[model samples]
Target: MTRRRGRHDGQSGASLHTVLTAVGANVLVAVAKGVAALVTGSAALWAETLHSIADTGNELLLFVGLRRSKKKEDLEHPFGYGQERYFWAFLAALGIFLIGGVLSIIEGVRSLLRPEPLSSPWVGIAVLVAAACFEGYSWGVARRQLRVRARELHRTLAEHLIRASDPTATTVYLEDSAALVGIALALAALVLHLLTGWAGWDGLASICIGLLLIAVAALLARRSKALLIDESAPQDVVRPIRDAIVRPDWVADVRALDVIFVGPAELLVIARVVPVPDAVEVPARDLVKRVDGLRQELLRAPAITEAAVTVEDVPR
Candidate 1:
């Protein structure tokens, strides 16, 4: 087995920074929104509070995932514990759906059934605006990172985000985006409640925020699940790897290749190759040296952390 270093091999610092930033922002926002919700009795503010709380908790989970994923390979897990990140991230998505989305919807329904007078509407308005600003800052950080990664991969933002293997990055970006949208919805609902004395509008806004969280949670969950199940690396990554492995003079032809993501930036590559007949006729010790050389060449690509190559006879 040949293993190479990857870009994300030691980049836990960046991922931890992003998660910590979000956790701090969401904790403050959640506290402020909770107090404002109590003062105003606004369903929208209550829903926003739940959203912030969910986000804070999710960030904590991501932090744990990042830490646990760094555990070294052991006898139990020969491939290492990298996939623990995806497992924890998947749990975080479930938490968002159950705690954030469900509770918001329930609160909205309750408010709609038994309308209550809202007091201190201005407090909710002020709190929501501040929360938007905070969430916006967090969103900006994630967006910057996303843009950098996308440029490196030569893919559009949407395309890169959809196929990204790092659950921490994707989760933070999606959570911050949802938080911003939820804040906007809360602001609009508060404004409408002030304009018209209808408590139903506030409740409706809460429902909208809940639905948005559900959609985001679903997407995150799907991505995490795919990662846990061992999805293949993107073509952009695989093609370069194949090209690199096939360039040597001793490699006559590459008959088959399979590349799968074993972790955020780790790939498990298995290939079958046909050697030049002259090269194959060499002594066994020389053949071993040539194959080792070929493996080393494949390892030069940063993303191909592990490679297995088999020499096969040319097909009739």
Candidate 2:
């Protein structure tokens, strides 16, 4: 089997950095927003507080995934624990939907019904601005990692996020991005409420933040589900392995090739190939030896973590 080099290790390290940074930032921001929400009674601030809380929890889950997925292979799970990332990320997405989206919407509706007067709107705005800075810093870190991964894969930033196999870094990137946008929405609502003396504006912003969180949650859930179900790797990954297997002169045709992502940046390859007709001249023992050698050689190739070869005869 071809052992994965340090490429995946580098990815995991980068993801750990991104998640840890987010956790720290979110914890600080969540506490500040919680205080601002209570003091100012701005519905937008309340919604933002919920958003920050959800993000803090989600980042913690992401950290767990990053750590657990890196666990070495065991007897029960010879393929390793890579799917732990997907499982925890899926739960994190659910948390975003429930805690951030649903609760924010509920708070907005209640605020609209009661129409409470704002006290110290300026305080809320100050806290929001500070939160924005923290979220911005975290967003930049995730973006930097995404850019590097995209460059390595020869893909655009958008493409990488949509089709990433490893969701650890992507989860942080999305949550932080949503947090930044939510801050802007809350900021706008606060300004409008302050100017018009209408608390409805703040309530409306809260609803909008709820919707944004739901959308983000849906996206993350979809990506994680695909990976958990054994989604095939992209064409860019499959094409090269197929080429390598078909390159040898003795291989007349490849009958079948199954290539899949058993883990992040890890692949398991199984192929059935038919030898050229002239191979009949070789003794059975030598041919078996040759086939075994080919299997061993394929295992040494880069990015091929596991491989199986079967030499099939051409049908008469």
Candidate 3:
């Protein structure tokens, strides 16, 4: 049995913390941006307001996913409701696309067709700067969590983001990154409108921010889809599990092994093993006991929530 534990087991609390922090920041930012958008009549500010609103709703969905994913196994769901997290996260991504990305693009096009003068440019600028600061703080919290986990897995930040089983953490990080960039675009557009008195620049910035959201939402959607479909664990985790199963002297060979990520920080392993020719001569009852013992030992790996082993005779 491999004794290596998964590093992510202890980070669930951190993921929840990151989600909560984002929810709080986005709520505050959304309200401020909405007021600024109404006051200044800036298309860019309006787009940003929509973006923040979508983000606030997405964060709430993530909170629901996190809570529901912790439900214990029952008669109906023998494996528990782990995939609920992925399902909700996927829905959140769709919300970003429909509510934030699509609407922003439409508003941008409408503004282009019929431009509107900005009431107070400085107010929008101040609001954008404050929003950026809040987003930066949230991004920092997510980045620190990813950094620690990536170091433990010996993977780069990009690799960890793509392969991490915990969707809440990754979603927050990506959302915050997009929010920061959107703030920059809105600020630039406001400045351009102020300098040139052309509202078209503001509309263009809104379009750009919409495109950014679309891209981020696509990436998150793909990741969540993969998780919902039961993606396999990485090779790094698979290899050690195989090594552990073959460690017992009674095992002559590991015929086959399969490991799948059933949920965040949980794995379902099924393995076929060939018993030593001499060991197979033991009574049938004893062989069953040995196989059960081996299964128990494999369960020691923190990520392996469930393991099933089948013993077979050595090849002639």
Candidate 4:
């Protein structure tokens, strides 16, 4: 299957669109949550405020990664900066863990130790409901993008999100999903606080939100780490590639084939192949020329950025 390069399409790409949608949502939600947190003095609202802020910053970092990764191949970097997405994404995840998760847990412990009376609890609830709408919209955008691609691959959305070569859209999708859940947690904390004169519920909710962020951050970091370490393409790509290598009648057998992801949707292929012997009638130059042509053909697949073929000389 041919995948279009995000750089080639500019901002119209799926990953870019998903990230932009998230940034817009988070900016507005963060402002609302911050105001509500101050008005209510609720631990849960404060934790959610931090979550929205971190998400906004993370999305912006993703934008930077997308832009930088688009730089055309240079002599210094022949493979292009496609993997820049992973590096920035890794950093973003780390930020969420430290800035969002760690601070949230600290805030929760502080609130638990010195329970503070909540003022204007209704206001916090109102803001959280609105925040849910905003976050839900952003999540929808990311979900639609994944659904389209997942259908193309005949894979479930969960399966595609985990294994898809591109992490940009998946990152947004996961963050937005978490945002929606966080809103619910904040709302529940507010309601429970009003129902029972207990600040512990509010503090516990904040801690739960922090743990949630940490889990998501860890998941994102693990995926990015694998990619940064040069993870291989999924089985679907490998199978098609193996078939393509020996499809030409001239190629008798593919002795060995290897494929590695160079970018989100780009791969490098190296293979050794034996050509069908024509009783030494075919010139070595012609045979080599055909083999090279086969290598070039691999470029037709959008995921395949480069390929190298070693052709066995025809028997004398």
Instruction: Give per-model TM-scores.
Output: 0.96, 0.94, 0.94, 0.94
Those runs of model 3 whose alpha carbons end farther than 4 Å from true positions after fitting are: 1-9
Tell me how candidate 3 scores on lDDT: 0.89
The most accurate candidate by TM-score is 1
lDDT of 2 at 284: 90
In candidate 3, what are the lDDT values of residues 1-316, reduced to their tens digit? 2323333446778988999999999999999999999999988889999999999999999999988877777779777777888999999999889888999999999999999889989999999999999999999999999989889878899999988988888999999999999999999999988899998998999899899999999999999999999999888778889999999999988898988887887898999999889888999999999999998988876777789999878767
Off by over 4 Å in 1: 1-10
Clashing pairs in 2: none
The alpha-carbon deviation from the true structure for residue 55 of candidate 4, after best TM-score superposition, in angstroms, is 0.4
Which scores higher on TM-score, 1 or 4? Answer: 1
Best by lDDT: 3
Instruction: Point out the worst 10-residue segment of candidate 4 by lDDT.
Output: 1-10
Clashing residue pairs in candidate 3 (N, C-alpha, C atoms within 3 angstroms): none
Better of 1 and 2 by lDDT: 2
The segments of candidate 4 whose C-alpha lies over 4 angstroms from its true place after superposition are 1-12, 279-281, 313-316
RMSD of each: 1.6, 1.9, 2.7, 2.7
Q: Report how far residue 93 has shifted in candidate 1, in Å.
A: 0.6
Query: Residue-wise lDDT of candidate 1 within 1-316, one digit each (tens)?
Result: 4233335654567788888889999999999999999999998889989999999999999999988888776679766777888999999999899888999999999999998889999988988889988888888888877787789899999998988888887899999999988998888888888898888988998899899999999999999999999998888888887887778888888899999887787788889888888877799898888888888777776766678888996545
